[model samples]
Target: MSTAAVVRYWLACDFHRERRIRAVLSSFHTAGGQLQPGIVDHLAGRRINQIKPSQPNKPYSAAEWERLAQACNTMIKSANTDHRRAVEASERGMESSDASLSEERLAWIIRSSGPLAIRSLMELFPTATVETHQLVVSLRRSLFPDQDVAFAYNLLFAIRTGIVPDGIDALLTGDVTRTGPSSILLSYMKGRTGKESLVLSRAAVRVLDQWLEHSALLRGHAGDQGSQLWLGTNQRTKEGGRTIFTTPRTQYRRRVWAQRAGLIDDDGGRLQIHGGRVRATFHHLKDRSAWTGRTTIDPNHSAKVEADHYLSSHTPAQKDAIEGIIEDAQTDIRRKAAPPLVTNERDAAKFAQQFPNLVQEAELDLPAVQKLLDAEQDVFVAACASPMKSPYAPVGKLCPARPWVCLLCPLAVFTARHLPNLLGLKEYFSAQAAQLPLPQFMGVFGPYAARLDEEILPRFSTWEIAAAAGNHQTLPLTLEEQGCY
Candidate 1:
């Protein structure tokens, strides 16, 4: 069959919801003529129609089974190749970085199942609780399935076993460099392609233990800077720490670590210990006493996306927001935008320091690039934000009770087409939620701190976070003694 035909057959597998499948594939109008129509996750042979009506497509004959297997393999291989191509394209976009998410690793993620996948996940996560486990599994299904389903499953397995598989940190960094095939764990399984690597690690078990005990080190920041750039997800490592992470989900973990570390101040402001990205955490730190870092959490996250039905902040606005985000970092990313320095981080940093400031001094403070990021966020916030409410509706605020239209939106099209991507977005949304308004659950919990009235930050405030280490002390916020969000 043609590539287009193969794509259509692949979609008609029995595992999919018919309505959902249609919604997802609706955009691929080109495939209409070439494909079979059915649910997803089915592997079938040529003349697959002979299978039971309700069952997944089947291999009618022995020869057909082999053909089906070949098709499945081909389909999977094509996805892996496509993913690598995407990765390569991204690398080229980023100036041709030498690394790529290798094929061996992608294969491992897709084919492996059971506890073996769990063992591989532990190196990055110490202990995967039920919630975390469910999260990992969901993320696995949503991650690049054609590429890293097992890798995702391994992450889920780690959660179940409380193991932290090695290289998980790399995954968080969007790195998919696969380690070589395993030997020790799978020695017992005969046919020995020696591919059965578990997702957890001995070190991860220890980390999980430490994490559970809240024993891992937690540092507070005393100051932070974030006036000209978006607070990056990964803060600089303390001294020689090997892992650097900034994905919204990792930021949540960092915030949890901070809470355990006792880093956030009495008020919602994050403390900068020496000069790390504590300020980075502040981007999402809405409440005092919990600078849990910025995240794009699930559920309401699309509210930002859904809000797109509301407004467009424009490119200039985007550029300004990025400018503020960068100013806080005062990095040279901006200078890199010019054709001359566009590819160099150092040059980027230099330009970040120079151009915008020059523009500010010259009084044309509304620089173009700053507006770009602002526009981006505004576009996103608007697009993703929910139009769940309207003046036409009858409610105090937009009722959260209305049905969400996630199933049919353009965003949903991708979510349905790629479960792992949806899962990633869910995790990202969850992380953002971790930083949102912590409800009292109807007078069940105490406030993180008293309300801030003496000091009303009319708008967002930026403080300079010098490069210190971790563990900064927080200034107490004396509220009206009465509490509020």
Candidate 2:
């Protein structure tokens, strides 16, 4: 098989081919760099293909990703500090005996502990020369800092945004554009949508920005490294403008960092960095773009290819999300899923009476909908004039009670789209009530609690509610989200 095809097959099955091959050959030993079983005859009748690949599962959780990032960053800070102090001591005209660090100790520190341990060793023995400490610190920092942080940031970005490892290294300053909105644009190779403009979330943007600053500092000493995104002690050639990490070193560094951060599985195997990130990107897009029927994470890949290679794993949330989507799709299949174009009052009333469960998808010239909104119903907006106090009150008149009280009020116009938002409000109030004293809970959530129980949820079937939640982004923003809180 071709190398890329082999990789895809391994990822599809979540297996390690090399390890499986080793297991198959455990009984054989090599002599003079050849298998002892006489390879020609052994392969003639061997059914070597019978060995099945083992299925593996090792994706990092959000908490685990954060831990690895923090761990990597902490080492980076310590390593940089050690370099600065040693350089400073050299500049101060201190003799070699005044500040000492041995090559053996430096090697051990770099291999096992961080810069702090090296500093502790230096302090333990004040007999070595300053020149020795300076040289050791400089060499260690040069080799370690760039690889340490570059791998961490690259892996984290890949996990969150689904940037391929090659794509991460291919990034340039101009590629990180913020044309509008909170997200920054990330242009990468082989885009499905003609060099598609991908976006990094606000959080990912912050980390990338930090890495950019550090990369600039490293560039001061990174001779001939060119403008490649990841810079180490390695030099770049003028023709290709590539660093040593352009090959397999990036993956090697990723393994090192993953091991250091305790991200290895209980089986002592590291997760598939590229495949894991791609899977995460698939699910994140599914979650944020639920209103859209399809996820567009890998636009270049066919749907069948995506299912086979990328979207092979599932989390509990993902399964629930898929089930919700299926239920919504089934509802769309059953109900008259199109809007009734009834501009006049008579037809509007007729449509409303016949399909009380359905809502309009297209805008009509009807005065009520026009007065309430000029655009499509992405979210439910209301002019509240309740006697109860509510988070929604600041949008209009005050409410004397909780927000769900507006559901029962005549001034509040609700569609099936409001179902998910209402259900979310119900859960929020329930949780709040759980922590309060009885009387306080009653005072806080008593009416709203009863309203959700006695009035709201029973009005529609659970399937109908689920369908409405997926109805083209119809849920309204909470008061806090709308700047009311």
Candidate 3:
């Protein structure tokens, strides 16, 4: 059994143990044999936390996958070319009896009279010099390849569609439903997932078409015997026996094909081709193509599985990119969590004592603090410590941020002097709240509005708020502000 099955079996055993414990506890209670409260709780809550095993198979490297794909393509192309030529030559009415034992005559005989028994080929060409086995093998290969060719089609299909080998093995002619001129909806049974369907890509569709055409002659000859989509002649048939078209179900045949292809691993050893690893490689390449600013996990996988199996095994560049994203997120959280600097006092010494780090970070001296208090460095809504040093804009550039952005900015300082403008901005927010939907207003302006009311305004006295409200002017909003709402 697989590792997953073993884990599940142990978990079931744990459950059965817990059930038996419950039964024993109930019998004890009936007999008036009291148990300790802690023991009873522990028995009732007993569970086995099974740690799932990590997937052992890793995807092929990009270069390795490309090499395998190119090899498959070459074999497929050669097979198709030979099949087409054989069919065209047969159409020219080339008589097999008129020619001697040659490649062209063998092709004509196979295409015209179906795959012949070796005894029949000997009867037709009685004086042939070549060995009977060699002749039959060469003719069958040119027309439709041996059962081992199924491996090439299966591998290419898995590489293109990310389907498991079991799914490809289970395919039938009826399972393919054409949705468009160049697309098909292929339905197959996965051993683990049961029945599933996928709309194949154009490239996958092309590969399927080629396989179907290449196997069509054998499929026709086999009739009902060739129900499986992957049909090829059995190469090991007894001498003088008819060619047998059947599905290639054995892994030995696939391994033989891999050996012929000379696939190699990173360590210069023979590549052990696993269906699951092929699927993983497809998903990996897909993820690389679809990657935006963040990691995009496959929807078919659980978040934990995606992270543990795929995301954990990254290249150095990918690791660096992920680290950068994490650092940016942590920095943003810290910046947003810092308390706003609001004070009514004009004493620069007291301000410096209250926010020594901020004063040093922004390089604000006593004269600069005094200037800030006197409204010499005022923005639309707050007194900016440094107008040209906004975090939202480049250093030494005037801030191009919206007025509401100042409410949460680290350099912004609120005092009684800026209260009238603050009250006016609050009024503007209220107007916007009325005009916009609740969700939209919350998404667009909720954080700034909350910071202004809950963190900045509450610091001032009630009389000061009243005085500011009385002196506040109702400034008209710009079209830029009104347009978005």
Query: Best TM-score goes to which candidate?
Result: 3
Global lDDT of model 1:
0.30
Per-candidate total of colliding backbone pairs: 118, 11, 0
Q: Return whichever of 1 and 2 wins on TM-score.
A: 2
Q: Candidate 3 residues 1-485, lDDT tens each?
A: 24344336546675555466557765885688776665555445644543456776688998889988987888887777867876675655374455555666666666656666555555665676757457555666767666767668777888899988788887999999998889899999988778999999989999999888888878777767677898777655566665765556466866777788898877898877777788888988898875555444665766678778975799999989999999978876887788888888788888889988779879999999889888889877788998888888889999888888888888888888889988988888898999999999999899999998999899989998898885665554579766865
Candidate 3 to truth, TM: 0.50
lDDT (Cα) of model 3: 0.77
What lDDT does each candidate get? 0.30, 0.51, 0.77
Error of 1 at 69 (Å): 1.0
Candidate 2 residue lDDT tens string, 1-485: 24344335444552346446444544443323344344334433433334566554434565555655566567656655654554444434333343224454444433333223245435644675787666555644643444655666665566556665455667666677876655678777643434555877877777676666555545544445535666553322243343334222356666666677666544456644554454555466547664545666677776778887767778889989999999867754443223222122234455445434323422223454434332232223223312232332453454543345454443444445456566677666666677667898787567657766665567667787677553333334466734631
RMSD of each: 36.3, 24.3, 15.1
Off by over 4 Å in 3: 1-56, 93-103, 116-120, 131-136, 239-249, 292-485
**All candidates' TM-scores?**
0.13, 0.35, 0.50
Worst 10 residues of 2 by lDDT: 336-345
**Deviation of model 2 at 402, angstroms:** 53
User: In candidate 1, which residue ranges exceed 4 Å CA deviation?
Assistant: 1-61, 96-143, 146-485
* lDDT (10s digit) by residue, model 1, range 88-158: 44334345333333333332332232112433443334544666555444333322231122222222223
Instruction: Please report the candidate that would top lDDT against the real structure.
Output: 3
Deviating ranges (above 4 Å) for candidate 2: 1-131, 138-144, 178-183, 191-194, 234-249, 266-272, 275-282, 285-485
Global fold similarity of model 2 (TM-score): 0.35
